[model samples]
Target: MPAGASTGLPLETDRLLLRPWRVSEAAIQRELWTERDPRVPARRRIDADGRPTVADFEEAISAAAVPSSTGLLAVELKADAAVVGYCGLVEGGPETEGEPELAYELLRRFWGLGYATEASWAVIDWARSSGHRRLWATVWAWNVESLRVLAKLGFAEVRSEQHPVHGTNRVTMKRL
Candidate 1:
C-alpha cells in the first residue's frame, strides 16, 4: 500500500485488479474523461479539443474520491496489467452528502465486458467493510450500460432530475 492510505488496499476480481493510483496513470485518467463517447455529454468533457486541459487533469487527480480512499482508482488487467480505466468511491454531490457514491469509466474499446460490475462490486464490498451503511450513484440518463451495471449490483432508482447538459440524470442507491 502507498503511504498515508490506511484502508487503501488492492481489490481483485476474475479479470481485474483495482488498485491504488499510480502517478504514471495520470495521462490515461485524462484520456478517459476527455475522450469523446456518445454516452458522455459534452459539457462534462470541459475541453474543446479531445484532450484534457491542465485544469481538468488536476481536478481529476489529487481530488478526494471516497471519504477515506483515493478518488479514482486505476483498474488494470490481471492478465497483462494494462490499464482499462477506473471505478471507485466518491463523497458525491450535495444531495448525497454523508453517503459514498460509486462511480466508474472504461475505455470504449473495453466496453461490453463485465469489468464495471466486477470492479464496482469489489469497491462496494470494501465500503461495506469500511462501515458505510449505503452506497449511491448518479448516472447520465443516456448511459444505458452504466445503468445496467448499477442495477446488476442492486442499485435501484432513488430519484431523477434534469441536468442542464445531460437531460435526465438519475440517482440510484443500494444498501450495504
Candidate 2:
C-alpha cells in the first residue's frame, strides 16, 4: 500500500489502487455516469440517450479535485491501472454532524468480483485509524449486493427511510 498524495494516508486494497482523481480520467468518469444502472436517480444518471453530457464530465472532474478530504477518488485496477470506478467519502447522509459518508461504485462489468467488499473494508480501516468515531453508508434496500457488502464490513443498519427513486434507503453505521 502507498500513501495517497492528497490525504497522506494509504488507500490501497488487494487488487485496487484507491488513488486521487485525475483530469485525464474524465472520459471514463463520464462513461461511468452514462452507463450506470437505470434505477438510479435521474439527476445523477445520464439522460435517455445513455450518454453523459459534457457538463457531467466537467462536474465530475471538478468534484474529484475537491482536496480528497471530502470527495470521491478513482478506484483503479492494480492489474492494468484501468479506471474501473470510484470509492471514497462524501459529506452528506441522513445524519450530518461531522460524519463523512462512505461511497463506492464500479462499472457494471466490474461488479460481482469482490472489489466493492475489498475497497470498502480498506475504507473502514482508514476511517477508523483516521480518528473518525464512526463511519456511515447509505444504500438502497433493493441493492442487495451492496447491503451485503455493508454488513460484511461490520456496518449495522441504523435507520431506514422512503426514497423518491428507490423504495427505501438504509443508513448503516459502524463504530470505529
Candidate 3:
C-alpha cells in the first residue's frame, strides 16, 4: 500500500493505481461530470452554464493540496493505464469532523467490475497508515451499487438524512 506522489507514493492495488490528478487529464473530469447519475446533484453534473468546465478542473488539479491524510486520487487501470475514476477521503462536515469520509466514482463504462471496491480498499489502508481509527461514507439511497460496495468493505449504515432532491443520504462508518 503506497501513497500517491503528492502525498508520498501512489497507492497500488492488484489491478489499479491510485494517483494524483494531472492537469492534462482535466478533460476526464469533464467527462465524469457528463456521466454523473441523474440522482447526483445538479451542481455536480453539467449545468446549463457548464459551471465545471475543463478549465475549472484544470485549475483545481493544478492547485490541489499535498494532502497528509485526505485527497481524491485518480483511479487508473494497471493493465492498460486508463483512468477509470477517482476515490479518496474528504472532510465530511460536522457530523464526521474528526473522521475523514470515503468517496468514490467511476465511469459508467467501468461500473460492475469491482474497481470502486478495490480502489477504496487502498484508500482505507492509507487511512489506517495515517493513524485513522474510523472512516465514514455517504451514499444516496438510490445508489444500491455503492451501498453494496460499502457493505463489502465493512461499512455499516449509522444514519440517514433527507435531501430535498436526492431523496435519502445514508451515512456509513467503518472502524479500522
lDDT of all predictions, in order shown? 0.79, 0.77, 0.90
Residue 2 of model 3 has an lDDT of 47
Q: What is the lDDT of residue 82 in candidate 3?
A: 96
User: Which residue segments of model 1 deviate by more than 4 Å?
Assistant: 1-5, 38-43, 49-51, 54-67
For candidate 2, report its TM-score: 0.84
TM-score of each: 0.83, 0.84, 0.93
TM-score (C-alpha, index-matched) for candidate 3: 0.93
Per-residue lDDT tens digits for candidate 2, residues 1-176, read 12554364447877988877777787778777777567777878877775576666767677654434555778888999998888877776446455888899888899899998888777776666566777789888888988988888888998888977568888888888
lDDT of 3 by residue, 52-153 (tens): 899999999999976667899999999999999999999778767557999999999999999999999999999988878999998899999999999999
User: Model 1, poorest ten-residue lDDT window?
Assistant: 62-71
Which one wins by TM-score: 1 or 3?
3
Q: Find the number of clashing residue pairs for candidate 2.
A: 0
Better of 2 and 3 by TM-score: 3
